[model samples]
Target: MEFIYTNPIGLTDLEVLEVGTQACTPTMKFGPGVRDMYILHYIHSGHGTYSAKGSSVSVVPGGLFLVVPDTVHSYWADPDEPWHYTWFGFVGTMAARLCKQAGFTGSPPVRNPDPSVPVDPLFSEVLSLREEPAKELLLTGLLYRILGTLTVPDDIPPLQPDVGLHVRRAVSFINARYADPIALADIAAHVGLDPKYVCRLFQQRLSMSPYRYLTDVRMRKACRLLRSQLPGIAEIARSVGYADPLLFSRMFKRTIGLSPSAYREKAKLENTPSGT
Candidate 1:
C-alpha cells in the first residue's frame, strides 16, 4: 500500500483545505471512522465494498464513492483481487459544497455510465501535480474538473426522473432553516445541488428564484407574526434571519408595500371589534 500526503497552506488552506491519495490492498480495511472533511475515491482497478449508513455497495473500475463530513464510514478491498483506488481528500467551504453539487451526499458509488471515460488519467493528473510549487492552486482546480465529469445537469430526464422530489427536498431544507441566517449555497448543499441549478429548478416549477421564494415565505410569516402583535420588529426580524431591524423593514416595504410597524398597526385596527 502507498499513501501520499500533502500539507495545506496558501491557496489550499483558504479554498481546498487538504488532500491526499492512497492505494490499498484487500487486507487494508479502515474503521467505522469519522471525517471532518470530504473524501472522494476513484477505483483504478479491482473491487471493493463500502459500508456506510447501514448499507454496503460493491465498487469496481470506473466507480467512485463520496464520503461526506461528520459521518462514520468503512470500506475494504476484495479478498482475492483486492482494490487499487485513489482518494482525494478535501475540506474548506468549497469542498463540501462542490461535492454536494455533484450529487454526492451520503449516496451510493458513482459509476461513470460511459466506460470510455478516462478515470485513470484524470486521477493521475491529480497525483502528478503533487510536487509542483503551485500544488494547492492546481489541485483545487483539478478536483473541480474531476467532479464535473461525475455530475449531470438537473434537467436530464433520465438522471432526474422526479424533479418534484428534488424540489421537495429544497422546500424541506428551506422550511427547516428559514429562521436562521442562511445562504443559497447552504440550501443547495442540503439538497445536493448547485445553487444556480436549484434556482433554475425553483423558477421552472414555482416561477420564482430561490431567493425570491425564501423572501416571499419570510414576508408572509412576518405578516402573520405582526398581526398577532406578539414579537417586536427587531425580535421578529431576528427570528426571520435578519440581524438588522432597519434592513428587515426595508425588505418588508419592498415585498408588502408597507413598513413592518405600519402593517402591524393596520392589521390591529382592522381586527378591532367593529363597534369599538
Candidate 2:
C-alpha cells in the first residue's frame, strides 16, 4: 500500500512526500532513472542489488538503501528470493544535509542499521501515520527520530551556544500553532521576549517579519492541501488558520500566484506519472 503526503506546512527541515510498502515480484526492477527527491527503502526481507555510480551493493533483510535526488540508479529484486520493503520519499532544503549526518552520503548508498538500533517500530509508525489526516508534524518528528538513531552520537558535532536560539524557538512556536489565531505577540510571549525584539530577531535571522513568516507558513500548507484535492476551499482555509474562505483565496493567490482550484489542477497535471 502506498500513500502520498504533500502537507509540508512549517516543516522546512524535511518534507515527506510519500510512503509505502511493496512486495516485489520476481526480478522486478526500476530505474537507471532519476528522481526529483530522495528515497530511502528498508529491506524487510529477501534480497536485491542496488547499483549507482558504477558500483552495485547486495542488500538483504534489515538493510537500507538511499536513492539521492537527480542521481541515476537501478535496483531489482532477486529472482529467487524477491524482496519486500518499506520506503519513503522526501525533499527539503535540509534533506541532503541531514542524509549526510545519517551516514547515507556515498555511492551505492546501502547500509545495515547499527545492531543496537530498533528501526522497525519507527517505520511501522510511519506506515500507520499514512492512514491518518494532518500527519505532517508527526511524520517530520518521526523522520528526525529515525535518522537520529542511525547517526553516531560521537560523530555529531556538539552544538555551539546558539545566538539565534530565540529565533528558532519562535519558528517552532509558529510551526506548532499556525492553525490557531496566533499573532506576533503570542510568539514573542512563547519565546519569553518582547514583541519588538522578536520582530528584530526574525528580520536579522530569517530576513522577514514575524507576520510575513507566519503567512508564508500558512500559504505553504494551503498549497499542499489544495494539491491534495481532498478538502473544500473553506475547510482548507480553516485548516491553515483563515476563518474566511474568500480571504484565504486572495491570500493564496497573492502568495502562490494562482487561485486554489487553479493550483490544484496544475499540480494534478504535473504530478501525473509519465504514462498513467
Candidate 3:
C-alpha cells in the first residue's frame, strides 16, 4: 500500500485532522483500529469492503465509507481488482452533523458523487496544501463546499397524504418567526405533525428541507438588512437567528454566493446616488 500524503494540522473550528490517498495491493487490508476524529474514504476506482462495529458495507467507484469518531473498524481491498482511494480525517463539533448531510452516518456513506464535481479535487487540494491563507477560514470554507456537494441516492419514501397542510403551517410559522431560534421539532409541534414527516413534506412540496427554507427567509432578511447597512454582520446574524458570527458568515456565503461584508458593500454601491 502507498499513501500519497500523510499529515496532521491544528485548527479549532472544522480542522482537517489528516488527508491522503492510497493504492492498495490485492492482499492489502486495513485494521480493526479506531480514530479520534471523523474520517471518510472516497473510492476513486475499484472496490472494497468496510466493516464497522456491527455493520459492513460494499463500496465501488464514487462510493464513500465513513468512520465515526472512535469506532473500531476494518477494511480490505478486493483481491481481484484492488482499490485506489482518497480519504481525509476531520474533527469539530459540526463534523458529525455536516457529514450526516451526505448520508455518511449510515451503514455505508454511499456518496454517488458526480465525476465532474470538485469534491475529489477538494480532497487532493487539502492533501497538497502545506499552508493556507488564514488556514482555519480557508479549510472551513472548503469543507463546507465539499459537504454541500455530497449527494446520496434518494431512497426516502414519497410524501404522505395531507402533508402539504402541515408544510404550509410550518412555513407560516417560520415566516412569523424566522429570527427566532426555531428547530424542526418546534415546527413539527407547531403544525401538530412529526418532524420527520414535516421534513418529507417540505422535500416533496418545496424541494427543500424546513431548515433550508428557514435559511432562505433569514438570508432574504439579511439582504434587506445589508441594504440598510444599519447593523454589523454579527448583529445581523443574531437578528436572523444565528448566534455564531463565523457560522453565520459561512451560511451566508453558501446560500448567497457572497460573504456578508461583500454583500453589504455591493448593496451600498447599488444603493448609492449617481453623483455620490
Tens-place lDDT per residue, model 2, 243-268, is 99999999988876689989899989
- 26-76, model 3: which lDDT tens digit per residue? 998877876545777878788888988777778888777888754688899
Specify the highest-lDDT model's number: 2
Cα lDDT of model 1 by residue, 1-276, tens digit? 334444434232123444555566558887687654567888878888887888888888767887765567898888887777777766542354456556665454355435755557778776677688877678777777877766655533332544667766777666567778888998889888888998888766555677775786577568768877999999999888789999999999887768999999998886787799
TM-score each candidate: 0.51, 0.58, 0.48
Model 1: lowest-lDDT 10 consecutive positions: 6-15
Off by over 4 Å in 2: 153-276
Q: How does model 1 score by TM-score?
A: 0.51
lDDT per prediction? 0.70, 0.79, 0.72
- Model 1, residue 32: what's the lDDT? 84
Best by TM-score: 2
Which pairs in model 1 have colliding backbones? none
lDDT of 3 at 20: 62
- Candidate 1: where is the Cα deviation over 4 Å? 10-14, 155-276
For candidate 3, the TM-score is: 0.48
